[model samples]
Target chain A: MKEIRVFSPATVANVNCGFDVLGFALDGLGDEMVIRKVPEKGIKITKITGAELPYKAKENVVGVAGLAMVEALNLDFGFEIEIHKNIRLGSGVGSSAASAAGIVYGINQFLETPLSNLELTAFGMKGEAVASGNEHADNVAPCLYGGFTLITGYEPLRIVSLPVPEELYVTIIHPHITIKTKEAREILPEQVSLKNAIKQTGNLAGLIAGLYEADYGLIASSTQDVLVEPYRKNLIPDFDFYKQTALKNGGLAFGISGSGPSMFTLSKGLQNAGAVEFALKKALKEKNMKSESYVSPVSKHGNRILEQK
Target chain B: MKEIRVFSPATVANVNCGFDVLGFALDGLGDEMVIRKVPEKGIKITKITGAELPYKAKENVVGVAGLAMVEALNLDFGFEIEIHKNIRLGSGVGSSAASAAGIVYGINQFLETPLSNLELTAFGMKGEAVASGNEHADNVAPCLYGGFTLITGYEPLRIVSLPVPEELYVTIIHPHITIKTKEAREILPEQVSLKNAIKQTGNLAGLIAGLYEADYGLIASSTQDVLVEPYRKNLIPDFDFYKQTALKNGGLAFGISGSGPSMFTLSKGLQNAGAVEFALKKALKEKNMKSESYVSPVSKHGNRILEQK
Candidate 1:
């Protein structure tokens, strides 16, 4: 195929107790990219649409990702890439990750030589680094591999896809406010007490087991976070109210999505997910804050070919 | 039944990456207890054997656990308890936990009034407190719940049993040396760098995912510890040698069992377990240290009734 179109899903990183280590993909909110082979022997971002993102080949996520992919494979190819971004920037929903993952995925398909998911993640992380000033893969790995992923190690780029329960729904509320990833990261402490560290470990373990066993109750209880959320929650307005209201309305668990002005809740069924979204929106409305809510099933697949020719 | 005999399996606490949070039970090593109804209105420890443990009712683990059980249930009947401990004290295996859990299980069975595993764990912690001066439940939770367990919380006694893969084997080597639990705990730092903490959390998430998915390779890679093992490994003789030797001989993972003079290695099959055990023994002999090695399948059931009359 000389041309391909791919879609990459939005991802929720940290996953409460699994701060810096766990994330999962969502089905509805994502970004799309179309790539076509050109006569030139170099990658280029010819056009961008649907969002106000950097268009430069080095500054843009899609361009950076495409460059990384080409350089890693030492391939001589020309590509004109167009991005149609749908995921919101600074909403803690991995918008840049979607762009990076989608472009690389589409380019790989167009070239008819697919890189491994881990290699794609490494390239995608270059795009994330362009956006966030560091190379981290918690969001990008899930965006590339689909389902729930654990960033087991960063030095070696180890990513493991964890089991996702069949009946899981993800309800996300994106407030009309933005928090820069760098500032949110700056608010965290450099050290944590050994006591909290151990508790966090237990919660992460519980969350993983819950996913495997499809035990909703265990998942709910294990979603409690004692590490990053305690410090970063203050950055998001009405964080506590939304979380409590969502839980009261039937959320199985609730937490900040990434470094958020956005929040995510998990529910076991579609009905409860709607209720949770309703509760979160109502809570936001009461506080005179504008918000948008999306309820989608946890995405079992990540980046995928939308069209091939 | 007027009398009952029960067995509580030994446990490996911390489980490398999950220090203070995760544990699993073993099949061949444990403690046995016999409890019988008496006319007296209180619990009593009438016999103690097979280990150098306290005989006094309040100070002994079996007696402490039995008293906690009787008090929690508000039982009006008296009980005579006998302990036949096979797990070695100060050996890093959950020796005291086995005693505590065995007595509680026997008493609960004899009275025909079974308590929930969490409640049993609470009583078991009381026994552990008598031994270690703290109410930690990492060892006790797995001893009571069986298989793999995550101690999600301590305040209200939250314990979750994790799945154990069928082909997994636990190989333990107990060196003829003593490392007091108190001293082992004292060696840990009160605080850890946030960077190390995050890495540890990733390892734990990886390990839990490994347990659920039955992915032995993930489990092996995730078993690396950056917390307690670093400080506590110094207390064991030739810990590095044994760990390296076992890994070289096909052990999937290796670490200190609890607080260690004892060490544990995980292997995917019985043949690997045997090879790991032989290698560990050879390493110890080369260092002029004597040790006993046991290879057993991961126990599917925790405390169980041995006999009733």
Candidate 2:
């Protein structure tokens, strides 16, 4: 039996202005996967959890991602996979992405597939599609490449890695509630105004230019979304307060992380990230809502092998 | 009377997936403004060419943008303004923008006020504010900054100019009819699906990353829009055929210029751009529509001073 272990960091998909195409990994929290090649050619699964997740191997999100890996390899390999989840699921921490990334990483290592990071990102998204019934690369790409990633144009699946300045710090707040991707998606618009569309595209362009120039001021300013956030923000608590605090406290940008119940901000340092957190918690408490927040640096590392805990 | 002549370049806003914050200038076409130091301390304006526009000086778009220039300098100089309309009005080209840009650029130089490109961008957008009653800066930033610019946020606006890629070429198809920006905006939805928003942001992120890395393929792949195009595309004749032809003929990216009645494609060379034009014309003929096309490079020059014609 061949036993392989892998670790994938929790990802914040839809980083501010990126909506669906941008994501970055957080170094501290994530999931660990243990895969064993057995005597059969199918997937057998188990899950150790933080949030309630499906466990039947074939129906599991990880199983779907593993299936893509197996199909790509064109080899018959029966696998037993154990996923230990650490990140809070449905709190916009990319719970399903951890398993998806871990499974892909483990399988690639096991099969010795010569897949590039971009390829790994594309492959990692099969699990996202399985979990959300949509192919979203934000969680997968960041979990695969670490740092920040831009998933451009979905048909050809363009993926690009961007520079993460050393001064950038991140803070996340999870309110301990499971807002499923489907629910989050349903609350969104069927269409957007042309005016809003232009604004969104322009902001996106500014954010990109900001990253290239390392102009934090532009990044912070360009993070506004006129299209989706205005509609979906209704689902999150203390949205306005957190946004204000993040900028007021020295964060360059802040927005709803992925879909809901969770939020994040990027600052020049941890000290300012504290202001971001304090602002979020204060607003949450003021609204009579309970939440836990974390402040950290941008994760420079992605998926890897971890010692079993 | 002190006559200060200023030329502004036509702009293509919403470069593919840039949505609201991204734009670029086109060479050889724009409006020209000549502001003279008059005896009075207020503004007076006159239009010599290009369709009927706001006739009054202070109530005019160009006059509004000029106000930003003078206000910044704290100067009360009265000026007589003459507009030389170069680009077509309501052809999906930035018509009012040229006037605004030209006037602002001329007045800024005339007063010797030193504002950074970003500051000037916000200032020039006072024209859009007058025209649309919305202080959006997509066109104004590109008009002021030249080349491609990203507008990341609104309010205390943030803008940045992206480094121009050496191999980039622009192919623009301007149809005969005009699509009013306001009417075009009315056809769009007040909301957007989270799914489409994610895709839009993703394509945009990819587009930004592509711009930074100068990866043409990724740039092409990331220029898609799922949110606005589906609904507004119906307003433009032969939209899909033109898009396909552009792609088949060597174009890397394609999208509506701003509202409608005009479209643009990004290519790597003149040869490919020509091929795209040929295909575009053929496709337009098949759909019973006619458009004048131009193949050129992304302009690094925004508004400028040109010899009087």
Candidate 3:
């Protein structure tokens, strides 16, 4: 295909218990992009809408990630990308990851021999790095591989796709505020007590096991953050109140979505998720904060073609 | 059923990446105990045969655990326990756990309304605390619940049972050395870098996911311990050589079982496990270290009735 339009879904990273390791993609909540093959040997961002972002090829995450994929393949042909964003920038719901993952996914489809999702994820991480100042896969991997993804190792970049429970739903609220990923990271302690570290791992293991078993109670109990949440929660207003609202409304788990400003709650069913969304939105409104809310089943597939030629 | 005899299997705790949280029970290698109900209201150690242990009920792990169970039940009658030792003391292969878990299992069999494995696990932990100077269920949970267990939360004490792959086998070699659990714990750093903590949880989450899916490759890759192994490996002589030998043979994953003196390796099949066992035994022999080794599939049952009257 010479041209392809794709939808790159938003993702929830850190996932409460799995800081820097786990993430899950969302359904029908993301950004759209159209890419066209060009004769030139470099990527260019032809247009962007809905959010103001860097337009330069070197500064834009979409361009940086696309270029990484092209350079790795040593491709002679370039691509022009037009992005239409629905996800808010710096909302901690993986706005940059949507663009970064979507672009590479589109480019890979145009390849004579398409790269694996794992490979696409690596290139997409370059774009994530441009935004976060770190080469982290917690967001990009799930956006590429879909469902839930676990980055088991970083030195060699091993990503594992996890089983998604059938009834799982997510309610995310993005307050009209931005918490820079770098600043959010700076608030964390460089060192953590061994006791807390063990607790975190236990919860992570339990969460992974619960996903496979489809045990909602296990998932709810296990979705706790001990390593990073305490420091970063302050970045989001009324974090505890919102979490209580979500939990009181049948949310299975609640935490800062990625680095904050946006928070997510997981629920067992669509109705429960909707209730959580209503409660969180109400809580946000009471706090006099402008916010956007989304209730979606965990996305089964990640980046996918919307139209192709 | 006023009297019951039970066989409580040995267990391997801290299974690599899951320190103080994960463990799996072993088959055929454990201790046998006989408990008799009397008109009295206290637990007593009637006879000791395997290894020398405290005869007083308060000092003995078997009595202490049984007393914990009886107190919770508010039993009007007490029991007498006879011990026949199989697992070695201070072997770090959960020798004390076998005794503690066995007595509780035997006593529960006599209860008109027996406690759940979860309740028995709590009682078993009391005995464990007497042995290790801490109430940890990594070993006891697996011993009571059978199969693999994850202690997800300690505050409210949540135990999760994980699936055991049909072909999974464990090879444990106990070198004739002793490392007290307290002294081994003291060697560990009170704090760890957040970077290392994240890596450990990544591996742990992967391991749990791998177990549920029975993906041996994922299990092999994820069975890594970063938090405690580095500091504790020195206590075990030739830890590196034995690990290399096991991995070089057919072991899927290898690590110090609990604290030290004993090391365990998991392999995919019985033949592969035997090969790892042979290689590890030979390596120990070459190093002039006397050791005992056992190869068995991950136990599907914990304590079980041997004889009853």
- Among all candidates shown, the one with the greatest lDDT: 3
Chain B of candidate 3 vs. true chain B, TM: 0.98
CAPRI class of candidate 3: high
Residues A1-309, model 3: lDDT tens digits: 689999999999999989889999999999999999999998989899999988898899999999998998999999999999999888888999998999999999888899998888899999988988878888899999999999998778899999999999999998998788778878999999999999899999999989999999999999989999899998887889999999999999999998878899999999999989988888999999999999999998989999988
lDDT of each: 0.86, 0.76, 0.91
Ten contiguous residues with the weakest lDDT in model 2 chain A: A193-202
Tell me how candidate 3 scores on lDDT: 0.91
By descending lDDT, how would the candidates be arranged? Answer: 3, 1, 2
Q: What would the per-residue lDDT of candidate 2 be over residues A1-309, giving only the tens digit for each residue?
A: 278778888888777667777788887777888888876886778545555667776678888888877777776777888877787666788888887888878777766546787777677788878777887787888888888877765666666778887778888888765676777777877766555665666677667667677777777767777766787777775577667766787778878888877888888777888887887778777778789888878888898776432
| Stretches of model 3 off by over 4 angstroms after superposition | A38-41, B39-41
Poorest 10 consecutive residues by lDDT, candidate 1 chain B? B105-114
**What is the C-alpha lDDT profile of model 1 across B170-208, one tens digit per residue?**
999998998887788789999988888888988998888
Number of colliding residue pairs in each model: 0, 24, 0
Residue pairs clashing, model 1: none
TM-score of chain A of 3: 0.98
Residues B87-140, candidate 3: write the lDDT tens digits: 999888788899889998888888778889988989999999888888889899
Model 2, B1-309: lDDT tens per residue?
267678888888866567566788887777777778766766677556666777776678887877766766667666778887877777766777777777777766655546677767766788877776787777887888888877666656656667667788888898777677787888877777545665676677677677778888877777887877787778887788888889988999988887757799999877887888888887887777767888778888888776432
